[model samples]
Structures are given as C-alpha cells and as structure tokens.
Target: MSSLRAFVFRMRGGLWTLLFCIILALARVTRLSFLLGLPFVILGQIWRFWAAGSIGRYRGERVGAEHLVTWGPYALMRNPLYFGNGLIGLGWALMSGPWAICIFVAAFALLYLFVIIPHEESFLHETFGTEYQDYRSRTGSFFPKTLPERGRLTGPFSFSVLRKSERHTLWTTLGGTFLIGLKGFFL
Candidate 1:
C-alpha cells in the first residue's frame, strides 16, 4: 500500500493526463461531449490558478511547504490543487464521451483521496506540526466547511507562481483539448 501510495504521489498527474489523452485520441468524441466537458476544465483551471496564486511563497515542494497557508482556497479546502486536478481530469473524461472514462475519473479521485492525500497529509503534519493540525481540524479536505476566514489576502496574485506551478498543466490541458477537438472535427 505504501509503495502504491508512493507511486501515485509521484506519477498521478502525468500518468493520468497521459491516460486521458491516449483514451481521447483513440475514442470517438462528439461535439456535445467536448462542449459539456469544457466548463469543468475551465473551472478546474480557475481553481488551480486561484490556489497557486494564493500560495505565494509556500508553493515549494509538493510534499512540504515553507509555511502553513490557510488563506484563499486553503481556507476552503485542504487540497484545492488536487481537487482542481480532479475536475480537469473529469472534464477530459467527459469530453472523451464514454461512461468508462467517467469510471476512470472516479477511480483517479479515489486514488487521490486514499493514496495521495494520506501521504501528503502525513508529510504536512510532520512539517507543519500543530499548525497543520489546527487547519485540518477546521477545514474540509475536499469541500469548503466554512466561508474563507476573514483576513488580508495573501500577496498580490503572482503570475510567476501560476506559471511555475501550472505551466505543464496548462499546456497539457490545451494540447489534449486540441487533440480531442481535432479528433472530433475529422472523425
């Protein structure tokens, strides 16, 4: 289980994207599927951007943070970035236009919840100690438990952070969508 978790933690992002892209490339995607799924992809990107922008200096390593960030999306959900990734993958699955793809998306989410988050949370707990515990006690892991705690917003939204955190995601999403759209167009 630990090895499985480690594998997921290391490879979930790239592997899942590749899986979705490969499936979409081979599957028959209709215009309706592309249309239906686009909103989810957009929303997911927005969520990721928001989370990345808000993290400011804390966007260090994935398994660790320089400081505990409980602002912006962090105030709402413990793992907003991962949640956003789920949305993006689900969007692509929907665009792929097969019920089986949806199952894959659900399975991916389950893996995230069970394998990835536990490992990440363990690292975070070790790193941030009581601060993370306090944040965890109050915040939902994947859902908003309360309104964002009133506080000054973290530093001005940083494009550098967004680019640093999401460049690959942004490009992969666009490229995959383009491929899927092209497939829909030609077939």
Candidate 2:
C-alpha cells in the first residue's frame, strides 16, 4: 500500500470536515434549498445507520475486515457506507449553493475513487481472498446490484452496533445541518 494512500485513508475524517466547512463558507443557502436537501440528508443518514449496524464499531484509521459481512446493506452494495456518504454530501451541497454539488462531486471522486476505495478494496481482497472477490464481482460498489444470484451471510443487525458506529456521523451531520439552517434562516 502506498504511504500516501494510507495517509489519505487515515485523513478521511479531516478531509470530510474540510469539505463541510468549504460548503458552509461558500454557501448561498436558502429556505428552498434547505427544504429540498432535507430528504436526501434523512435518507442518507438512514442508509448509513443501517450499514453501520452490520459493520460493528466504527474504526477511523484502522483498515481491517474481521468478518466478511454479506448480508443486509452489504448484500446490496459493496460500499453502502460510501454511497450513504455520497447522498449526505449531495444533500449538503444542495443546501450550500447551486455550484456546491459540482465541488462535492469532484472532491468525492478524487478522494473515494482515486485513493480511498482502491486502498480498501486491495486490503479486502487480500484479507478475505476469494470471498471478497466473489462479492466484488456480484455486488455493485455504490448501489444495490442486480445480481443473477446474490450471496447472503447470516448475522443479526444490532442496534448497539449502529449506536457505536454512527454517533460520530450523526453528530457531525447534525452539526452541519444546524449550521446550514442558521445560514439559511438568519444569515
């Protein structure tokens, strides 16, 4: 693994924070934009919460897959977490300004496509061997795949897992939403 890739992977949180701050700073937020964006935010968070439930505790810098989770959202997409993040980013972009979506999309592609996903995929492929490759072929990376034969892994989706894994995401998203609200309503 490239050291640069590891650094970016580790710095994902900071990068996302920077993106949010950029959106807020360059905002032309309005009531209509906020309203339009709310559904996306809600849906994104829900998707993420569900995905997190299956994945157990959130590991920020650590990149290791202990179990091959092949059920629920994992069964749907190889990168449900990233997909949910995409939705959330789009929502924030919409709320921020007309041009913010372009910026967010560009940033997302650069980060996830160029650095993050490849690194993670390489690790997963090495860690899980044939299982991960099989999953990769059958499942879509960012969307629910229409596999001719979808694989399933048996496991319980725990609320505890969701709570543990999603608190940071929940708070961060709420904070962004609140700031956007302030910008839209007061500023």
Of candidate 2, the 10-residue stretch with the lowest lDDT total is 147-156
Steric clashes per prediction: 0, 0
Evaluated against the true structure, the overall lDDT of model 2 is: 0.86
| Candidate 1 ranges with C-alpha deviation above 4 Å | 1-3, 57-62, 152-156
Q: What is the C-alpha RMSD of each candidate to the true structure, in Å?
A: 2.4, 1.9
Which pairs, if any, clash in model 2? none
C-alpha lDDT of residue 142 in model 2: 86
The residue pairs in collision within model 1 are none
TM-score of structure candidate 1 = 0.86
Tens digits of per-residue lDDT, candidate 1, 15-55, equal: 67667756676566788988988898889988998988887
Per-model CA lDDT versus the true structure: 0.78, 0.86
User: Could you give candidate 2's per-residue lDDT for residues 157-179 as a string of tens digits?
Assistant: 88887887799899998999899
lDDT of 2 at 113: 86
